[model samples]
Target: MPYAKLTITVPDAVWIGELSRAYPETRFRVLAATADVATGVARIEITGEEPEAISEDIRDYDTVTDLTVFESDERMRRVQVETTVPLLMTSLQNSGVPLEMPFEVCDGEMAFEATIPQQNLSKFGETLDGMGISYRVDRIQQDVESDPLLTDRQEWLLDEAIERGYYDTPRRTTLVDLADELDIAKSTCSEILHRAEERVLKDYMGDEKGARPTVAVSSD
Candidate 1:
């Protein structure tokens, strides 16, 4: 829930080993040590949830001096943990939260999240229910609006088109139908709507153009 910074004196060698073994996830970097290098104070920034949430690690550092914790639980929660992948699509195909593989090992210190489209979320939920799997949807489909390139008018037109099922496989609404409803020329509507649609799909595809850059590591 919050990041905590703890100040404490480094205990004896035995205690140090015990603390390390005890808190596997707690990172203990040496901010500074004693002049003799045995009884110096150190700052231990625990990067995780609240102290109570992750209290098991806190207990080990009972002897830490100037014991203080500084962090904002609210500020931590405000961070938008946006995911680049289509979570629901992946969940449906994979059948669950695949925490491994390309999902990759995340930093224990960082916030975690998943973003899924509304339709995919609903489908995934129904699948889970059908399979008798116990799960809950904690969030809603974040409606990502079309990019800045589209004017407000064009964005509204495109959104209405999608809502009216104009993009459906069966062609739920024809260009003539939309024109009649909006009392506008089909050509003008089509151009605006197409531009809006392109922007939305572009953002969804992770980029409007070109491939993501690759990193090449040198042996040196």
Candidate 2:
């Protein structure tokens, strides 16, 4: 038997059914999958061998789209924590606070800035007791990442626009309206938006080289 990996970008609603039928007797693994309701983009990865043949006792699949080969060294893996600030806050409140001090999560691996006095740290640490969370206030500021999309000029523009009430939650103005306000053409504005989006993904996600799947024909 020969193996292949299929990186299928399709609708999540139909993926499970298709997968079951496609590899009925074959042992397979779902390496990764992402379903975003907002974008309706579902990225799925599955790897398995051909337990049954689809051609004249030859190649595993008759169509090329059904196969994607990968080198042995290629891999995908990561570690992540899933929790929101609101949930964390609710958990915190459920624990108990010894004082009335304002603080922020700072949203990074290490370090934080404190407007409140340093004494508040121990009190907060005590509050974190039953919550199973660890936190601290540090005097040093560390390096962190900004959005991958924003250039200095682009970030400056977004900040200024937000400050000027351009893209409010209530939808103040359209992109064309903002373009006119910035004295740039609509097409130029669209181009900037496209470039900025692509740059952010490329910079942050890294350029993922496409894997070409393998096909094998075998006969006893």
User: Best by TM-score, which number?
Assistant: 1
Off by over 4 Å in 1: 1-149, 205-220
| Candidate 1 total steric clashes | 1
Task: Tell me how far the alpha carbon of residue 149 in candidate 1 is from the true structure, in angstroms, after superposition.
Answer: 4.3
Query: What local lDDT does model 2 show for residue 198?
Result: 71
**Deviation in Å, model 2, residue 178 alpha carbon:** 0.2
What total of clashing residue pairs does each candidate reach? 1, 3
lDDT of 2 at 167: 60
Q: List the residue pairs that clash in candidate 1.
A: 1-49
Per-model TM-score versus the true fold: 0.28, 0.24
How does model 1 fare in lDDT? 0.45
- Kindly list the per-residue Cα lDDT of model 2 for residues 131-186, writing each as its tens digit: 44444333323335455557776666666557666667887777888789889888
User: Model 1 reaches what TM-score against the true structure?
Assistant: 0.28
lDDT of 1 by residue, 153-189 (tens): 9878887888888989998999989977988998988
